[model samples]
Target: MAEGGYIDFHVHLPWREHDPREAARRLLAEMDSAGVERAVVIAVEPSLKLFKERVNAETIRKAAADALDYLVYMRIPRLRRILFSPEESLNEHERILVEHTRRSEDVLEAAEASGGRLLAVASYNPELGPIGTLERIKGKRYLGVKLYPTLHFCTPNEKRLRPLLDYMESEGLILIVHTGCDPGIWELPDLCSGARPSSLEPVARRHRDLVIVVAHLGSYSALKPGIYFDEALRLIERYDNVYADTSAVDSFLVELAVERVGYDKLLFGSDYPYVTGLTIADFVESILRMNIEWRAKMAILRWNAERLLKRLGRL
Candidate 1:
């Protein structure tokens, strides 16, 4: 790895056992090719099983329609998995929790196998409550917690989650919440509504010491209006603990993010595997092309993330 090497703040590790090790191998290979020194690898958080149980057919139908719109716009094949096989569920919350545990274990193993090139982040559904989830990860070697409000159908400021946020702050666990819009098998509007960046404001204010990262820079709606891109920017501007990542968004949004959020708070992230058609190399190259100084670009690509990991005691 180079001195000031690139660190991917976001990347997904597969839950499917069919060939997850091989998939991770491919991911590491891509990272090596792209000159990514290290990556914070996380497990997929969406539970199709939970969605199947909690959502009604009308909502699923709406989600299907939204999936169609997304498919047409993005022209990606991965989105079809949720639409064609909507019945396939991961089971109930218990099953989902079990799967998440297994996925976290797999990620830890992958991190170990990487010989320190990968850092594992634990993913939990806040719906099950934080105490039980914390018990599962007790004494585990992970740097952060991954939250998917859109997939879990909850908000960060939910009364029940205050303890969880407090615990994260106490434990020095970085909270990487999935913000902005999410599509595929889940109801689009509801998921988007739950994950809006503003929803995190209260929690960010309360847990001012916790490191909060709003993934995708809250521009999940692309260049369209009605999303929380501006809200995300405001949070970062208002709170020193709040930060944003450039994951699964276009270069235009990246330009906007750097100009507004500044380089110190921006981190490089690749929503790999889910962010189809782009390799880690492509993602890194996009940042290289952005109209920013080399030092700022390096900060976004590595220094900022490395600094955060050090603070979290992961580095």
Candidate 2:
């Protein structure tokens, strides 16, 4: 790894607002400004096929309102426990719908154009046939697959996802799973349960060969801070292949993770566009300022992720 250069394990192409090619260029500029040598740009697909038939103008309107409320409460932590409450969980007839989908092709195209400054991670919605999804990303240049169990309304250990996990492990690809709560309609209790880090324990136990990076350190939600922080730490401590990322988590949790599992098990991730008001440099600075050894800071900021990418032959 280059001196003073760190890898951002989690970042996203601005598929919602800008063209992926343009978004890639903008991300590179930001990285250059932040001293980020490389980043893993994740593609996301929050849209669900089961809810497609039920989606209409009214549902979309309600979804937008839910998203706005979530954003507001995120900015004001006090409002989370007081004002924010969904009347009902997402059911068959009523559910949140996101029209936009970030395709893996767009992410790959952008990564290909980044001159090795970026690595692509494809997104998978298990509801959309897992085997077919596997076939789609089989020969692609993706470093791994990112799974949003809470957003997709599924669990990591779902039977449908077995084939995909099996294939990734066999091919030496990594698995980045969303192990914390999500905002908007996903904040509901039912959806939140899906993202619990405990649900991933079985998957980790079964697929010991597959490298798993638990995103958000299993405690990213403003509404419920550190909800599954302990569970995430336990996995990292118990499984050699299981690790956690410091994306969208509080600084104290990072300290706690180090105390409990040490620096080698932690990776630095900025969550990028979703981090809001913070640059990749800001995250790097936070780690640098931590009350730990200089070597630990370097491991978290760059070396840890550099080792993973190297194993995958991406470096």
Per-structure clash totals for the candidates: 1, 0
Candidate number achieving the greatest lDDT relative to the actual structure? 2
| Candidate 2 global CA lDDT score | 0.79
Candidate 2 TM-score to native:
0.85
Q: For model 1, how does the per-residue alpha-carbon lDDT over 48-158 read when each residue is reduced to its tens digit?
A: 566666675456556658556544655434344445544443233234445544366677777777878888888775445577667766677777778888767778888
Clashing pairs in 1: 49-90
Candidate 1 wrongly placed segments (more than 4 Å): 14-23, 60-102, 185-187, 222-226
Give Cα-based local distance difference scores for all models.
0.74, 0.79
Model 2 lDDT, residue 10, Cα: 91
lDDT of each residue in 198-267, candidate 2, tens digit only:
8899999999999999999999776677878999999998999898899998888898888878999799
Clash number for candidate 1:
1
> Alpha-carbon error at 309 in model 1, in Å?
1.5
